[model samples]
Target: MYGLLEVHNPENATSDIVFVHGLHGDREKTWTKNSVFWPQKLLPLDITDARIFSYGYDANIAHFWARPADNRLDTYSNDLFSQLNNRRAETPAANRPLIFVAHSLGGLVVANAMVDSASNSYQSLSSCIRGIAFIGTPHKGSAKAKWAQVGRQIIAYFGKSTNPELAKDLEEKSEKLAKIGDVFPKLLKRRNEEAKGRIELVCFFEGQPMNIGMIVDESSATLSGYESILLNGNHSEICKFGSRDEENYTKVVGHLMKWTREFENSGTTEEAKKVTNDAYFYGTNNGLQQHTNSGTMTLNFGMRN
Candidate 1:
């Protein structure tokens, strides 16, 4: 079975949160730093009422030999849906309100899983998803994907073989990625309109660049009708929180609190409707940058220096 590590599962919790790591990321190492796993050590401490889980799959960057078939995003999505569905059947509280936290390509997997769940026998799983937090997800594709493809091709030319299909899917204008981008929003809107509960979304984009340059630019990360926050870190660093005192950690917790509150009140009160409506129309005011050191948050739509 694909790795499904439970970080924390307190008895009598009302909600569940799952984390999906990006490419080349392990369920444990993806969110760990200096031997401290934030999902276990920090997140559960803040969001004490929910059970936390981290999902893992085969996402290695390089392969010495080419496989018989191409492993597409849909394959990953199917695996995720199957695992979650099995859990829901096994655990009594597993079907409770669910929140997803995904990074990079994992975000695409989550999106596809939601779409698949909505149309299949697993619609219940779609309904249980209350919120999704995306970290540097390439909704519109990214330049780094092309760079990765080039690197893989170079390696293959030298001697070692690699899976070109996976790399090709990451291209900015690839048909696979474009199809997902087209269908995901429509599916989400339909789900929101049909269900008594609403699925809220929030995106966090990395402001700093790494050795491979900006993996996902601001344009590729932001989604319509969701709050997009720019944090002071690179692609990988954006998901790694060393301490609770860090700005990135605090912002993530704040969004989770808002989602949890809205989820709890969903379909029960008129105030919840207002909250959902307000969140739908929440404007960025030309965008904003939050400074954690000076404790200053300002609206600046222009490029970040």
Candidate 2:
């Protein structure tokens, strides 16, 4: 199976955005829906001449739930690369920048795709990936996988969910998810380190003041030489483009616009580093741009320039 895709063509555009979604998410649900889709919000920005593309993959949740976890890597990674190659081929060869806006599991796919592109292992592709905005990516492994393992054990004990796909997947992967849980800490740490310094890695984390303490500080989330911004909301609401939260949706749009323009003007690493702890309210552009109540990071586009 392949992922869904949406290409908003603008002839002779200088930049193109490729959108990727996370687990249990498809092209439309993650990028197109009016409720919280990113493309909708980004389209309204003052970007006069740009193209937007949504990259979907064969990340069928049912298959993921049924197949072994590692099996997912084998299945999805190639398609991820293939989708990017196809998109590049469709481009008009203007040597423009490509920006990836990925959510959740989509971030993982984007990373793998970049790794593949770097190796030149994928066919008919170019290393035009400029910047990335990872919204609530588990650059660290997910806590939910632990819960899923517990649920699987309970189901196994009762011999429940005996459907063939479920049964096969459980039999194949029951042991692996547990081991994955055990090694997740180190794995996540390594992933965080490996991810930094590769292009621009912008991570967006949740900070709704949950009783569970899910949000980590900016140091853990921020990458070297890249900027980070925290918003005020949970994981799900962080991606809401036009959300009433103001901090994430409204304010983020402004920051993103500023970052894009700046990146285009002077390229990366052109700004002075000034860590300011300013407070601003929602509804105002300055309030949204400089506010830090949530956990989201963005790496401005144009690394190849």
Candidate 3:
């Protein structure tokens, strides 16, 4: 199932939060450490009033004789957009405030998704997004990307490497990836200019280094104007937490809580509340019918008299 899954849904939820994993990362495994799934086990304890979800995709940069050649970063972003938009559309959560927490290349996908949502067709998707927090995501490029290119070449020498354009896109200074890095910030800037629901963005960088040196340096993992937090682990460990009190979890969850509360008090998502209706019939209005809607309405209907 390469789509979104609702991992946590509580009564009277105030927002919907999605988790997108990075290259070669599983939706659940990316945020789990020592067999503890933080989003399910730890996060809900702190973020009690928000629904949680995780999106999965085939993120391997280079596959040894893998499936189709159509799988690319652009394709993944579009998949995420389609899945998220359709899942929320016409549902009680359609206009609810949304937050995206992504790691590594998942951040790029989130960035591109954010930019794509600006179009008129995806206005609902754009307006619902309230905050984004990226962990060890390569906003520019990372050393691991260069390694992916090298790995591709090494596998191609054996005639087993499938052509993966996403590898090239992730390479350090690749024009395509750079374009995403460039346009993403400007899109957020435009949102600020509109003075509408300005999306809150935060970049988290890994403080330690992997055996291949730091995978993503601070300059590559962060934007200029937004807030950036430094986590106390390596690229692989920055998102993993064995307990709620871990420094990484504390810093990250603290920001998520703060943002959720801010969105609640701001009333920015008032338009997207749950779709419900009530009617009263009196006198000769026996055949009266009532219809009310919230968010992007679809064909589905439910009624109670």
Winning candidate number (lDDT): 3
lDDT of each: 0.70, 0.51, 0.73
**In what order do the candidates fall by TM-score, top score first?**
3, 1, 2
Which lDDT value does model 3 have at 191? 78
Clashes of 1: 0
For candidate 2, the TM-score is 0.59
Please identify model 2 stretches exceeding 4 Å from their true place: 1-4, 32-38, 41-44, 60-70, 123-126, 141-198, 209-226, 243-245, 266-305
lDDT of 3 by residue, 200-230 (tens): 8899998988766677778777888989999
* Alpha-carbon TM-score of each model against the true structure: 0.74, 0.59, 0.78
Q: RMSD in Å for candidate 1, one decimal? A: 16.0
For 5-26, candidate 2 gives per-residue lDDT tens digits of: 5556666355667777766566
- lDDT-best of 1 and 3: 3
lDDT for each residue of candidate 1 in 192-226, tens digit (9 for 90 to 100)? 78556567889999899866567777877888877
lDDT measured at residue 287 in model 2 versus the true structure, 0 to 100: 26
**lDDT, residue 210, model 2:** 36
What residue runs in model 3 are displaced by over 4 Å at the alpha carbon?
62-71, 141-173, 273-305
Number of the top candidate by TM-score? 3
In angstroms, the error of model 3 at 221 is 1.1
